[model samples]
Target: MRIYGPSGTTIGSPAGNTKRSGSTGFSLPDDAASTQATRPAAAPKAAANIDALLALQGIEEDPVERRKRSVQRGKGALDVLDDLKLGLLAGNFDASTVGRLREAAANLKASSGDPGLDAVLSEIELRVEVELAKAGQF
Candidate 1:
């Protein structure tokens, strides 16, 4: 009677020599881009939106990370301010634009450690809040 166990050259193995077969390469196409292009673009955009939403919540507050995020928020708020101001000048302060400005203000609450920049950010945030409130009353 023979008991079957590991056949490879491992500890307590019965045989020291093992026979292995050569692995054949898969018959995949060389042009990966062609295959990838067939996928629906909407799937990637939805995944990107989810990733962005996650990134926005509970962001790391390490000094370097905070500075990077703070700069992003400041720049984003400024861009929103520019757009909002331009739209206000053009008499286009619809609810959508007001909502976007409010969102920017909310995200721009972090201080960047610079007195001058902090003051400017505070002013921009205050203006956005005031503008949104005034728009809401109308």
Candidate 2:
């Protein structure tokens, strides 16, 4: 393979084209040229951008953490279901308990990034829905 460079070019003063061609030149917009630009300082803008990036990084959940959270939520939902069952058997269940079960069902809808866990949660949600439906709350 032949590596070709500019013809007749030397290390010093290569091509030596100092003039700007019309095709390569740039012009500002007429409105921009007429205004005194009031741009914010670079430091604050850079700081703001860095802060925003950090905030976004913080918002992203780790897969392991998300899975753990989903497990905890599932356990909580199961606990609530148990409480509801106990309440019903004891004839003390009320609207608030049903509301909590509904909320748990809603929370279960979020993905845990694990197919197995998701399947389990879906089953739990279905059970919750069935219970709610039986109670005429659905």
Q: Which candidate comes out best when scored by lDDT?
A: 2
The per-residue C-alpha lDDT of model 2 at residue 119 equals 95
RMSD of each: 13.3, 14.7
Model 2 scores a C-alpha lDDT of 0.79
lDDT of 2 by residue, 7-75 (tens): 643555433323345785644435545587778767643455787886687479798988998999999
- Worst 10-residue lDDT window, candidate 2: 1-10
Q: How big is the positional error of residue 55 in model 2, measured in Å on the Cα after superposition?
A: 11
Model 2 clashes, total count:
0
Clashing pairs in 1: none
How far does residue 95 in candidate 2 sit from its true spot (Å)? 1.3
Candidate 1 regions off by >4 Å? 1-64
